[model samples]
Target: MDDFREHLMKAISLRKRIRDTRTSTGIGWDIIEQDYVLTWVLFGISRLEKLQETLIFKGGTALKKCYFGNYRFSQDLDFSVRGDYPCGDDLLELMIKACDIATQSAEDVAFTCKRYPEKSPHPEEQEAFDIRARLPWHKDFNTSVKVEVTTHEIILLEPEKRVILHEYGEHLNASIFVYKVEEIIAEKIRAILQFAKKLHERGWGRSRVRDYYDLWRILQEYGQQIDTASLPLLVKKKCESKNVMLHSVEDLFQDRLMEYLNEWDHWLTPIVPDVPERDVVIKELKQQLYKIFESDNEGVRVNRTNVGAA
Candidate 1:
């Protein structure tokens, strides 16, 4: 058993090295950039907690764990607060105060706060006022750090409503709790469909289509038990807004899903190879994620285990 365990560990390590190589060779640096961004967001969150404003992890990072394996890289940090809890101006003041406590200047951070503006059919229908902040830092003689902070309102839901939306109603989990696997898959499906339409409209590269296809495959393989009743509604809404064709969601489960799964298995699966300096990158990320969650001096805590082993 001990020998088997050692071999397993060795194999895992090798696989990780190969995966890392693949990521580095591709646009994986975007993921690393996102990690840096999240680090700054966590710093701001820590500051916010000092001022008595609680922030919860939401959106893609949460989905990275809840849907894609935690190993995937996410590009942004999103948080939501109760609509009636406080005004946007007050939240900015609190955030600014938190920065002051940390001896960080407001100009050094990307900070934006605003209410969700009304939506209409004008050309600017998508435009809304949002509070945004930028925190800048000098990393080295040539490198600098800038972190963006933005605040927006989501419909306030009762705890039960939030739970239902997070657990079953929505594809991505709501901010009210730890993200779940099912919600992530559902959200990704929605995102894929949306992106596909955008691609069709712009006549752009097939990246979005390919990613949507890949995500669909991953979800189908690992997300068979997901509740899918709301999927059609989600597809219809996103497609209607984007002016894209509404592909049958059932086709996602039946076919094309396996093709992406096979691609991931063949391309992403790690191979046993000696690679130095690999552990350093993984260790740094783990530490950063830990620091962000731990710095919330307030009682608010993220259910870290829910993200799973990755």
Candidate 2:
């Protein structure tokens, strides 16, 4: 109980600190709120890591907070397990426990969490939780944080440990599981492929601009570190697991990467300031994707682009 109180006090203190630091120009209050929520989420994940060794953090938030520094503010926490989570344990209950532990560390905000059961039979598409957090001091700001669990086999090749610092302050450190940089890059590529597949079947959905941006950012910062030889197989395995078939990995890249280009600036400009000029980013990404796909098919060629239309 004392620990919980300490967390609550620290949370409130951090909340005030974040509120006070919201003077940065050109960034909206909503974005600042998003940052605040992200801070709380990181603190929450830190607590979970202490209590649950099974859940290893992955995805955009992990990349942003743990490895990649170039990503825009991400709204959710994603995790994958080494194997099936024990049967009959409610995910929401588990998150609540994690949240409680988090509140103990910083109890400034109120957390409301709801579990959405897995809608698909595929093990990879596991259940998710929607967490809505409201700071008691800031009535106008209620942030939504999604927590998605990936049941697919997470190959944590060259896993790295990162101590996540609450941006409002640094004394609070939360350690998290982060996959190798190359694996994360492969995952981003896989995300674009998956997004394309979903779009083809449904005709409309969320955008994959973030994946493109993250891919570009990683390639720019850690391009040499990415395991070039292993990427295609990794991406292929991911597509197979999701039952998402692709006629050609190169074609998949050409179609999706091109499509995402049209909306890139619209979605990316606000969050990522140094967003490379369109032609530069697209050209660079195409070259990288082609290299990843070349080992499998030599016929891979860059699709002609009408930069003006895009």
Candidate 3:
């Protein structure tokens, strides 16, 4: 750890010297700081990949950081293991050990990484657990990246492994298991619908604008090519297993989606420099969601036909 600290200090000093020589590009220091913190997190995530072979990276963070290139500056690292690793306490202990390895690996490059065991609010809901990564340099500003692990659902498609090269840092690469784009889109839609349902019933305090933003980005990239046939049914099953109601697509868009749109703040202003206008996003999203629901229903028909033929 001491050796890691020494390397980190030198790197910081070098970064300061470089910044002093260069003219400002008008990018906010807050964003720069966030990028720096992300590099450390990436280093740790890379180490995590090495530690657990079964861990398949998923969710918004994976979409933004590893693939998609949408750059949303997400704060959580979500993973899905191949099997029910939650079967025993020992697997979690092993995962924590892997996190410690990640901390050491990050420390080697001068970033201090610390892990905290986060208690689940409702473990029975999804058998989910959290491990947060605390970065040293960004301690003053949003220093922690929460890593959530779960083994609740099965992924139908085989995950593809890709080597992610850091956009901000030099000489940084991490190979990770990334879910297919279709899989990601399906899950994102499911999340938005589910969250919208919650907002409709519970009346507003917990609006998740990020999910909406992601869904819009996915639509822009994939358009009508995405397969969401099984997504609604999967989400329905998930909600049922958790004893939550599954709302209709029309209800989600008519009421809750507009509510989520209203909550977009500084935190989720699209970290990418060239972002679509808010009104533009809202318009496109409405059109896209309608199309997506139609496509998803069509997929259900296709699947039913294939099963009947079989």
Q: Which structure among the candidates has the greatest lDDT?
A: 2
Candidate models: Cα lDDT each = 0.37, 0.63, 0.56
* Candidate 2: residue pairs that collide: 4-104, 7-104, 7-105, 7-106, 7-107, 8-107, 11-106
lDDT of 3 by residue, 9-57 (tens): 8668745633542224333545544445454555555575343467777
Compare candidates 2 and 3 on lDDT and give the better one: 2
Tens-place lDDT digits, model 2, residues 1-310: 9987886777677666666645532445566666666666666655764324566667767776776543566667777765446322565677777666555655466666677555666445576777777765657437777777776655636566777645565456567666666777767766777777767788766788777777767776777866777766666665566665444545445564576668878887666645668667666766666556644333233333432232
lDDT ranking of the models: 2, 3, 1
Off by over 4 Å in 1: 1-40, 46-59, 65-69, 78-82, 85-187, 205-214, 217-221, 237-310
The ten-residue window of minimal lDDT in model 2 covers: 301-310
Residue 81 displacement (Å), model 1: 7.2
Q: Looking at candidate 3, what is the lDDT of residue 31?
A: 52
Candidate 2 segments exceeding 4 Å error: 1-25, 49-51, 84-89, 116-125, 153-158, 245-249, 253-257, 297-310
Query: Residue 193 error for model 2, in Å?
Result: 1.8
lDDT of candidate model 1 versus the reference: 0.37
lDDT of 1 at 150: 25
